[model samples]
Target: MQIPTKFYKIIAIFSLFFLGILIFLGVVFKIIVEKRKLPRLYIEEKNRALRGSIISAEGYQVAYSNKLYKVAVNTRCIDPQKKELFVRLFSIYSKIPPHEVRQKLRQKRGYVVLSYTIDTKTAYQLKILSRKLNALDIFIPYKVGQRVIKQGLTILESGETRNFPYGDTLTPAIGYVSKYEDSGYTKIKGIKGLEKYYESKISPKQDGVIRGKRDIGNNIILNKEAFIKKRLDGYNLHLNVNMLLQKNIENILDTQKADLEAKEIIAAVMESNSGKILAIASSNRYDPKNIQKRDLPSLNPKFTEYPFEPGSVMKPMTFSLLLEHGLVSPLEVVRGYNGRMKLGRKYITDEHKFDWLSAENVIVHSSNIGIAQLAQRLSYLQFSQGLKMLGFGKPTGVDLPYEKGGKLLPPYKLKSEIYKATVGYGYGMTVTFMQLLSAYNLFNNDGYKVTPRIAAFITLENGKRIFLKKSKKRKILSSKTVATMHNILQKVVEKGTGTVAKIDGLEIGGKTGTAHISRGGRYQNAYITSFFGFANDAKHRYTIGVTVFEPKTKHFASQTAAPIFRNIVIELINEGYLIPKNEQ
Candidate 1:
């Protein structure tokens, strides 16, 4: 009890030294535990690139991806005293009324959403405001639905959405996408048109990742470098479609559709030698950005999807084959049987009677009997193989999705003489508008069959371009045969059924076909009329096709379809194609 001052000092020093050792060991143990759990505490961040754009030939962005956001407010975390301040600030940035913001903040929930789709500018401003408010929140941890007297706000990132600048101009060809969710991640996938066809090339491929450590305060450590994996955006698709021209053609079809009371009008213009589709238009269109249930039926492009009996537009194809085989000549005489003749059990007839007609006049007049008479010269094998060579009963292999490769009766079916005669005039078979267009292009392209293409090339993120391979051209007819057919087709416009398609001072060639739409195994009163032709000058030529389905006002192609074909040519001339010298 009565120790000396020096002894007391020595005891105090030993006690202080042991206490210091214990504190040092505790600090080391805490550091070791934190280090062991560092992997779980490390921060992982990902950045995604924008989806690829769909660019038009005119350099317009037909379709693209844009970022969107969703904002939520922690109602329970908002200080009861500063509730008005939170509402005012949020209302100012979100463009929502203060009263509406107040109503949303009154909810007794963990987080209440204020806006599901705030724009980029608004989102950025709100994010800045969030950071400023978080200065105080950084020190205090807020739990879910705590009802604590504090200020708290949350902004969650929503995914990307597609934007269409031209509204519904491009239609089903441009296609559309639907949202898909896997695990906990969400994505948008193409479901139709060119979008579905080139999904791999136009969809995002990789997302950048960043791995780094965060401090206990959930802040990134500035001294440590993050490991990053570069993000890769999808490739851009540049199409062969001309936006202005496509609109022009669509306008033409719309006007004609209303005037003719036609159920539908489909048209396309293609470069003669290149097979590049300048424009593919339809009278019926729906918005890709906001599709409806009724719009679903209109999404399938009629140009590639719908097949029908092409009627007389197919006569030229059969005649070209006849010329190719030397089985018939333009000047050769054949009896027309006064417009009607029995081939097998059925009788073939023309619109006009004739005692005898030259083979050239047969095509010029679009005489069904005359063409059938010429077809009689060829055996079933010869006739069936000829249509097959003209790209019949096959898809044009367009880049667009859901292309139908129209049906052709087999040789056995053609063995029947009645079917053979009907086949010569575009019956007992079906073909799409694209196939018919491509078949007629041979006459304008000097007999070389060119494949139709909608996609021109693809551009990568690194400024490198990858062009789609061009389809190899096949020689299906001799140039001499082409010239003869061209002459006959030209006369059709100048003096026959296609005279309505003839423009003044411009030389055009085409054929007009009127076919009765069959329903329940019998021809109906409704008719499908069409005109397939070309607009040509010394310097340039373009193959154009127009089809009028179920015209209620007029049944003949010359009245319903040919005039539309003429208007298309005139529109081309107005757009500096085949312009006359005086107009130029």
Candidate 2:
């Protein structure tokens, strides 16, 4: 055993050979990796893409874009054995879903975004996490600075994110946006409301290059050629809505939401002649900032979406139809069976007892039996045509999203006379609050039909502005018929259930509606209290519609919606919109 010098020499030679090979391989690998991850010098880039803005007619920015960042990592460079630890630590700072991090770690190569939302503060913490673990593999696409590099984390200036300055105020109407990445390209998608409807006009994909030049320190150079972007910025939508009126509407609702015990309340104000929406509001609102945090039900938009039985508000249309077609005169009397009448299988009831009432009394008293009796005289064609003339059974053609036309059955589908009778009293049919508003505006606009609109105009960066033209004009009723209808509605406020809506020395015409909301297969006790009206001054006229749903404190529109309507008019007038003749 002591004479084993040959064996010892052989073992030493083998060990030396293996050690030299190991050092050579290590040097080669380090050189390749270092070259591959070498820092670059002086970069030029462009970001010509700018998300468009939504502005009001008064030139206030409602929705605009703000820059945001996305943080990501090259999975191949991260420690493989410590993938779980990496995921846990990454999620702590990134706020990304843990399961999502795990799935990305499985890739073990290429790139996976830790978060599409790395802000300035968060970007700093990400740097700390990366430094503590030394796991970040920086790959700056364009700009880089000390601000850019923290620990080993990569900060990608991932273009812009949308912001609503007024929060949920115009959300359902203005809509919202979401982000997605496909084929190495990032995009913003308009997901709802006006955002989606005007997507092509507003936040369309970029049309030009976003160019910029930077020095070694990532300092942006201010050179014309170095930073040039042929910016075809999206057009700025100027809404017809008046911010003053909109604010007043919302403020009043907020103060009354709890007192009314309302599950929801929807109201709209439209120009009597042009149908331009001045203000539209809802009680149950959603915030675009924290939209994802709330339940989906909270996001249900009521302005142009919620459709319900329109109730006695339809009485005016019934009276207008009878007047327009010369089917009946204002003073013509109809038997009401003393405020109660059975027609076929159903019965119509009135709040007041009336054996016989004038056709005008039918509307003034909001008598269901009276209107139903008058409706029995008309042919199905006349009955259906009357509703159509007032924009019922049709979508109001509003630019907002998810607008429902509400159901309108043809004459043939009328299962019984009761169904037709119910339609007269605003049952067996459904309509959106906007549609109801537009229909009533016919009386205020001197019988010339007006189509409801939300957008007023669009302004572009080049100072070119295009105003939205009025829809094709159509006269649905004669001037005389409108006058007659207006007189009847005036009587409703003066001597009827809607008396609470009356303001001193102001001529107003309104109708109250209280209908049981249909749920599951049958009507429920849940009610939609509504008041549709026009507030008239010498020079100013506004048509308003207020609807409150499932109120706990009150079940009547006169109690819940009318007084709110009165208060709104008072505020708007006090704000100097309406001026009475006596005051003038």
Would you list the clashing residue pairs of candidate 2?
A: 45-211, 45-212, 46-210, 46-211, 46-212, 47-210, 47-211, 48-210, 136-152
lDDT of 2 by residue, 1-584 (tens): 38688998999999999999999999999877764544544454544355778787677888887656778776655555666777888788888778988886576555667667666577778767766775243222322442233224566666567778787785567777787864444667678877787887786445454345666545566677554556576777888887777877888887778898888777888878888888888766777756865536656567667778888888788778878888889898888788778777666788889888888988888889888877777778888877877887778888877788888878765435777678888988888888888888988998887778889877677878888666886898999999999998899899998999888768898999899888798888888889999998887789998988889888988899999889888876887778766688
Candidate 1 vs. true structure, TM-score: 0.89
Off by over 4 Å in 1: 1-41, 135-151, 183-185, 215-224
Global CA lDDT computed for model 2? 0.78
Candidate 1 clashes between residue pairs 3 or more apart in a chain or in different chains: none
Tens-place lDDT per residue, model 1, 373-452, is: 78777778888888888988788888888899899998888777678778889887899999999999999989999998
Lowest lDDT 10-mer window, candidate 1?
139-148
User: After aligning candidate 2 to the native by TM-score, how far in Å is the CA of 406 from where it should be?
Assistant: 1.0
Query: Where does the lowest 10-residue lDDT sum fall in candidate 2?
Result: 138-147
| Every model's TM-score | 0.89, 0.77
